[model samples]
Target: MLTERKHTLILIILLVSLPVFALLHLNSGQIDLGIGTMIDSMFSFNNENMNEVIAREIRIPRMLTALLVGGSLSIGGLLMQTLFRNPLAGPYVLGINSGSSLFVAFTIMTGVTFFQSDLGMIINALIGAFLFGLLILFFAGMVRNQISLLLVGIMLGSFTSAFISILETMSHAEELKVYMLWSLGSLQKVEFHQLGIISLIVFLGLIGALLISKQLNLLVLGEREAKSLGLNIKRIRYLIIGITALLTGVITAFCGPIAFVGLAVPNMVRILFKTQHHIVLITASFLLGAIFVMSVDAILQLLESWMVIPINAITSIIGAPIVVIIVFRRLR
Candidate 1:
């Protein structure tokens, strides 16, 4: 009863803060539109006015993108952790993000042009992430030990990084410049339509995660224990990995490879909730992830007055230390 009440309080806090932070996100910037003006512009739907145009077209989409991408990455990390039975596991562990990045780089640099549409980049990213995910799945099947699977994931990440470096070296300065900026990561590039698509994908992936939450909890015990309970461990593991890949692929394709939100948010949720139940942890992680991303984005906007810094840089600075602390604590 106390746990339920605590979770209810956290939910209420998140629900209240979400809009407040979003408003702060809207009001912030060099233009400095007030709350009343922003609200008026939102209702008017007429972009004839400058403030409305900026608010509607620029800030709102970016804010939505941050929420969706942050939520997706956080859930992806949670799924990875459960599947691998490793607290430090993240989307990048299986080379999913690196795979997406490689494909994006190839499209921009080598003129490979796999999917020649507005959504081309997203399609290519999904393909790359899926392929890498399959590779990881196949290798995981071959290996019995968890540590070996982790080593394989690390090796795959290293391979993808090396391939990206080779592509960078061969590309022209203009293409290289574009790829570098994307690699740095930013939320400023999202469009309204893209936000809709990202939101839908993220929502679907999260729902899939929720449906399998019970299986995830079972798997957290041990393979033998899960099997004793009649859980389909193999199928559940594959499903989790695939869903995680889809979530990571879509976010990376649209928002660039965001760092640390995936790694940090799940751990934060686990600690905050003080329970390993996937049902509660997943919901808490999603809300906390959205809040953390928006808060960081708000800070970035404030910092832009002095200079523009990549979102990834800001997140890494904050997230890496948290990761180290978690690792050391776990070791002890």
Candidate 2:
């Protein structure tokens, strides 16, 4: 009851802050909009008005993308950690992003223009992320040591990155620039139409993961325990993989491969909440993750005049330290 109450208070705080963050994000770009003006434009405004155009067309989509991407990746990270029983397990850490990058690179290198559409790229990236993710699972079966598995995943990322380098060298200037920009990762590029597709895929994945929360709770207890208690470990593993892949692939496809949002956010939530209950962790992960990414975007807006920062770069720089701290704690 006490833990629930504590989490409930945090949850309420998050519920209230999400919109406040949205409003802040809406007002956070190069040209700032005041709260009164943001409300006026959102509630009642002329269609031809410039503020309305900026608010509706530009800010809203990016804001929504940040929330969706952050929430989706965070939740996906939670599932991956549980499935592998490794504190360091996550979509980015496990080579899911690398897998997606490899396929996305293929699309650019081979000029598979057919898969170049928003939907097509999504499909291509899905295959890549899912395949590499499953490959990690295969390695998980072979190697039980978390450190060994971590090294394997890192090697997988390095291997795919080498392929990407080769592709870039063979490509023309235009293709090289396109791949480079995509690799840099940003939420600003996803338009309203693309946001719609991302929202659908990610939300469905979230729902699917949440529905299996009980199984996740049991799975964390160990495969033998989970099986003794009547949980289908194999089935749950595959389902977790599917949801993680869907969430990671869609976000990577649209926003580029966002590093550390998944790994860092879930670990942060666990530390803050101090519980293994999937029910609490999942909800906390989504809300907290959304706030985390929005906060990063706000910081970027503050530094925009002096620096052109990629969201991925900012995440990696900040997240690496957090992950290292977590590693030390786990070692202890």
Candidate 3:
């Protein structure tokens, strides 16, 4: 358990580190712009210089995507855990990622650039996640076994991946390259231009999470207790599903299926903060989640001396262990 002072200090540390890491992300990648150069590009627009363009236009968008996706997914994880009353529950665990990935494959392989804009990708991802995510919920009701339900979700993901693979086989090289990169997951795809829509949608999700915080607290007491206290568990569950789908779909559409942060960050925050209050958990999750991901991304930049590791790969490397531990705990 953390002392109140320690909790305050941790929050302060996270708040301080987030901007520091964001700045590091802005300056640390391949081109290696100095902080002065990075700041100048932000304060003074420059169209001519390659360094400025890379600093202001390229890296900033990637940083924003990292921050937004990490934060949104972490909150989504927290929401899923609270709604399902299952510590191991997460957006990716529920087939949302695979569903979004499947539709994205369709868009890339079919050569339909019609809705290829950021808005279009979000729409595609939202539809895909909602369909499969809702299906998982429906199945959860039928299968009383949580582990079996999780297995079913995994099978759903595998089914979607098989479909994605079929699409890949039929796709031309150029199309395959596009689809492949999307599968690998990169912050590089998002430009500053796409930030507006991403920000609006993610902000909406965060707002929804905030509105439900109290209800979530009630839920932590258990469904029967919550119902006795006049809480509508069914309505809250639907709302959480909608919010989780929106956040997961938008982030996956833009950033691909960067995994683990959602599953890991919420657990880490709970361990560190030692509280389930949605007020504390949600805020801490966002701050630490953004910092955790930006730090991973920074490590990826620093590691450019060796190989350009994919964001998803690095995240899985770090998150997989924590997830395994959580599973053991769940089983225990």
Candidate 4:
């Protein structure tokens, strides 16, 4: 009862602070837009007014992208960690992001004009993520040891990286520049028009995750124990991978290869909540993850006048230290 109460209080605080941070985030961009203007733009878009246009077209989509990507990556990390029983597991650890990067690199570097479009990029990314997810699943079936499966995933990522590097060497300067810009990661790429599709996909993926919360709780007990409890381990594995792929793929398609949001956020939630219940973990992960990314982007916005920084760089700078601490704690 005490722990639940504590959790409830923390969640309430997070829920309240989310809007506060969101409002601040909306206002943090280069141009100063008042709260009244931003709210009005949300309800009544005015294209002629530059402030309204910036609020509706630029700031709103960026904030929403941060929220969706942050939450999705956190959930993906949680699912991967639970599925593999590894503290360090994440969405990109299984080479899903690498697969997306490879496909996008090929498409862009090869001068494929049709596939260079936004829609084409999304389709190719989804295809790459789905295929790589299946490949990891195949390897998971073959490997009894979870650590071995992780090794397979790392090797796959390394292989893809090598291929991408080779493609970069042969590509023209313009194409290479485009791919490099994408690999750096950013929340600004999403537009208001694209949010509908992105939101729908994220909503479906979150729902899928919630539906499997029970199975995830069982999986935390171990595969044999879960199977003994009448859980179909194979089916659960498929579901987790499918959802992770869907979330990770779409985020990568839009935001580029963001690092550590997946690996770091769930671990943070686990430490704070101190629970094995997926329902609590998932909800907390979503809220906390959204705040985490939004905070990072807000910092970028504050610093925009002085220096330009990639979103990926900022995340890595913050997430790497957390990862090191996790490693040290595990060693202890």
After TM-score superposition, what is the CA distance of residue 152 in candidate 3 from its true location, in Å?
Answer: 1.7
Error of 3 at 89 (Å): 1.4
- List, residue by residue over 1-332, the lDDT tens digit for candidate 4: 99999999988988898888888898889888888888889897788999898888889889999999899999988988898887777877678888888888887899988888777887788778878877887887798765577688899899998999999999999999999988888899899889998888888889999999999999999888999999999899889988888888889988899998988999999999999989889888888999999999999999999998888888888887876786677667
State model 4's lDDT. Answer: 0.87
In model 3, which runs have C-alpha deviations exceeding 4 angstroms? 1-8, 169-173
Candidate-wise lDDT, in order: 0.81, 0.87, 0.85, 0.87
Better of 1 and 2 by TM-score: 2
lDDT of 2 by residue, 140-205 (tens): 999978878889999999999998999898988888888788988889888756777888898899
Give the Å shift of residue 131 in candidate 3.
Answer: 1.8
TM-score of 3: 0.93
Native-to-model Cα distance after best TM-score fit, residue 63 in candidate 3, in Å = 1.8
TM-score of each: 0.91, 0.94, 0.93, 0.92
Which of the predicted structures, 1 or 4, would earn the higher lDDT when compared with the native? 4
Worst 10 residues of 3 by lDDT: 112-121
| lDDT assessment of candidate 3 | 0.85
Give candidate 4's error at residue 104 in angstroms: 2.1
Q: List RMSD in Å for every model shown.
A: 2.3, 1.9, 2.0, 2.1
CA displacement after TM-score superposition, residue 75 of candidate 4 (Å): 0.6
Model 1, C-alpha of 78: deviation from truth (Å):
0.5
The true-versus-predicted C-alpha distance at residue 123 of model 2, in Å, is 0.7
Clashes of 4: 0
